[model samples]
Target: MIKSVLFDLDGTLLPLNQDDFAREYLTHIGAKVAQVIDPKKFVSQLLASTDVMVRNKDKTKTNQQVFLEDFLHKIGVAREILLPVIDEFYETDFVLVKSITRRAAAARQAIMAVIECGLDVVVATNPIFPASAVRQRLAWAGVDDINFKLITSYEQSHFCKPHVEYYLEIAAHLGRLPAECLMVGNDVKEDLAAARIGMTTYLVTDCLLNVKNAVINTDYQGTLQELAQTIAQIIKER
Candidate 1:
């Protein structure tokens, strides 16, 4: 019995080319903070810090904490100096990247179908970004109106995707066993990592991302429309 549904954002619910989105995102955010630090240097250090966050396994610090500590240290700036600027950028300039993302009608359908079944819905996007950025992306995906049981963000999550620990952390947050959760994502490796923890996996083929061309082994695979139909069938069986 699946008690919760976890959906990956970028390539899953939200259709986007990762590289293109990152380029547009960095361009906007870099411009926003150019006054405090050279945009070139800022982008470089920001990425390095993000890489540190991705590899971080420190349970003692949230991903945000790890990112900020390293980013601030490397840039030699106080949090008070850089944080507000970034926050303002997220509030104002972040929407500029939305043009690159198309709203997936099926994405909304799948999430609503899960909610209708009374299953907890979680936006299980990689926790490398701050909540503001994640929330904005969700808004662009057109699924931000409904409440999510948990929205994984750097402020809360300690691990990144493709790491089994990340799935475990989400399970812990939901107070549910991995066996009772269904992970839906487009990444062959990152999203399917949930299967390693005994969670059922659904691979969304639309906007699929298999960078390394790894063998894809998922319990269910199809478009978002098919996923919604699959859930409907499960509900009928129940």
Candidate 2:
């Protein structure tokens, strides 16, 4: 039985021009941290740190730790001086970037379907941001303020998506085997990677991110608005 659903955020639940979202996020975050470090330098170093998080292989260190270790090393800033600034930025300024995202009421309904069936739900967004930022984005998507049983964040994660290990980590965290979970997302590359670990997949194609044009096999496929119906049908059949 599929005991849990893993949902990706960026192009799945939240419709967005991913490029614009990243640009706006970096711009505002750069401005916010400028008081402690040069804005240009901060942005560059932050990206470098994020890269570290993405390539992280050390299960012993969280993505956040990997990011901070490289970030603080590159910029020579003490963690005490930088963490609060970034945390405050996520708490206050990050919400402004929500303007770049288009909302979908069906996204919430889809989540509700999973919840109604009593299946555990995990927000399997790439753990590239802080938990606070993740919660805020979930709010913007009308997901009832972090209703997911688990929200992957850099602080609690060791791997980023498109890596099978990332999906495996989530399965382990949820105490479910890969075959017992369903991964729902719009990205052909990242979201589909879950299948490599034996999880079933539902491809949300409205804002699909299949840049490589890879042929994918999805157990179910539809747009975000079609998701609730899909889940309902799945449950009925089950």
Task: Return the top candidate by lDDT.
Answer: 1
Global local distance difference test of model 2: 0.87
Query: In the order shown, what is each candidate's alpha-carbon RMSD?
Result: 1.5, 1.6
TM-score of each: 0.95, 0.94
Residue pairs in steric clash, candidate 2? none
Q: lDDT score, residue 236, model 1?
A: 46
Check candidate 1 and list the clashing pairs: none
What C-alpha root-mean-square deviation, in Å, does candidate 2 show against the real structure?
Answer: 1.6
Worst 10 residues of 2 by lDDT: 229-238
**Residue-wise lDDT of candidate 1 within 127-228, one digit each (tens)?**
988898898899888988989999999999999988999999999999999988999999998999999999988899988989999999988899887987
Can you tell me which runs of candidate 2 are displaced by over 4 Å? 235-238
